[model samples]
Target: MFRKLIEDASTWHWWREWMLIFLGCIMMGTAFVFFINPYKFVPGGVYGLGIVLHNIFPSIQVGTFGYMLDVPLMIVALLVFGGQFGARTVAAALFTPGYMNLLTRAVYPNEAAVESLDPALLLNGQLNLSDDLLLTAIMGAVIIGVGQGIVVRQQATTGGTDIVAMLLQKFAGIKFSTGILLADGAVVLAGLLVIGFGLGTGEAGEKGWVLTLYSLITIFTTSRVIAYVLDGASYDKLLFINSDHHDELRRFIIEDLDRSATYIKARGMYTGNEREMIFLVISRKEVRQVQHKIKEIDPRAFLVVTDAYDTFGEGFKPFPSADVMQAE
Candidate 1:
């Protein structure tokens, strides 16, 4: 019985999912502690609110505020979404903030420094771009986007404004994307007033609008990264090859590249000669390999390669469910 339990724990799926969560939380933690929190940029989400609240209450770290917001959101998600969420969602929500707190402390010399956000401590003073908020916005956005993407890829949703977005989708009949934009926009507006316009903080609001602009840039950049990660982008290429060495190239593809190809009976439009055309999909890197091999095999071969955006198959992304495809 003990060995059986151990074997079940050691299964590939169990470790792989946990690894995703662990790595993703680390990414988010670093981004919050280093880029987003220090600058008071409200990039939207509970953490964005965290930054706003942290400005008002410097005693509490941004991740601590994230913890404060996430709990209620998770509870609401549980009541509303029910079986839609699993352990991974709960774990990711609870873990990321605590990790961020740790990172904040680790980087700063003390709590006072953390609150002040001393420039020298942030990213070893290499990324303290106080004078360059635009670059910092982009950096934070890309990091957090990739982090959130990794978590989402593993079927885990961090219970932040994602829950609010879904709630809007459910009760108000708003689209999910629109709901997210509205929620984040509200947060950004809140930041503009709280931190930018100087509502309830010690900071001055004279130059707050500029930070608001940078916050929007962060939001836009993060969305692009998340979209790239979720959609997998156009990293793969589709190719069609017509060459006398079809058999040899096919063999190379199968044996060397360990990739499969399809053969289509074709006749040239002008020549009217019948032959087998090699059709295949491969990654951008593998395209160069195929090109080099083709050149070696038949210098005069007719080959065409094009971007294969969002390919779904055995080696690529799995096909979405029927409902998802229909929505697409």
Candidate 2:
């Protein structure tokens, strides 16, 4: 049974999914070691707060603390987000702790011994101005954001706060983006509290606030960029047409529009009558053309259009293409 399941997963492109997850792990690990951990700059998510906590209380291992934190969130996800989402969260939660543990052991040792590239700035207490807070925060955000984008592209997550967001979205009817805000907001607030207590009222305290603000900015900017880059090229339109003039519509799309169409059997929900459904995936620009063609065939045709954010096949963007020049 286990072997059969493994084979089934393999057939369904499990290796590609795992590769994306591994890429996320590398990005998260690098962000932790290079930016967040070294500079004591926390991000917005659970991992961000973990960095702060790890700095304040060096006795507790970050990996262990992070795993402990994510356990309850995963339970909430299971109860609220259903089996598939919960299962994916579980995979991410498990992988994160192990990955962080390995990173700590491998990378943290080299951190203290390594010399800063901005050694002169460090000697003059100008490291923060030069490349300390802002640089770390931006780099951390970019790395973590790209990692998250890759995971999301594969229809997975890094668990932690993301699980909480999903659960809130499912159970509380909160928007996913808003849920993310609430989850990460709490962590950022915690980081502020930690910094306030640790650095009292002094120049150091003011500097801490600056770091916090910059970190927040970095996280937001990086995540947005990742989402935009991942989504921009993938937005296509899937059009479904059911009409008496199916032949005309199909001909127009194939010949005039230079698009392909697939015919499928569909039933009217109200009438309970069999019908032919014409399905075609086209670029956003081509949607208007498809609409015009449908109208030209039958103005009364039942048409349904859905946004296809990621389509993998022929005649789609991101496929190999030959450059062509238009003569004037």
Using lDDT as the measure, which candidate wins?
1
lDDT score, candidate 1, position 49: 91
RMSD of each: 5.6, 10.6
The CA lDDT at 328 in model 2 is 7
- CA error at residue 302 for candidate 1, angstroms: 20
- My TM-score estimates for the predictions, one after another, are 0.70, 0.60
The sequence of per-residue lDDT tens digits that candidate 1 reaches over residues 1-328 is: 9998888877977799789877988898888787888887899999899888888888998889988999888887677655546477788999998898888888887768888776667757876778877778898899988887777666666768767766775677774445566789989999998987678975666788888998998887776776676665678999999999877897899999999999999998899999999989999989888999999999999999998866888998887752220101
For model 2, residues 47-75, the per-residue Cα lDDT tens digits are 77776666566555566678878788788
Query: Candidate 1 — what's its lDDT?
Result: 0.81
Looking at model 1, how many pairs of residues clash? 0
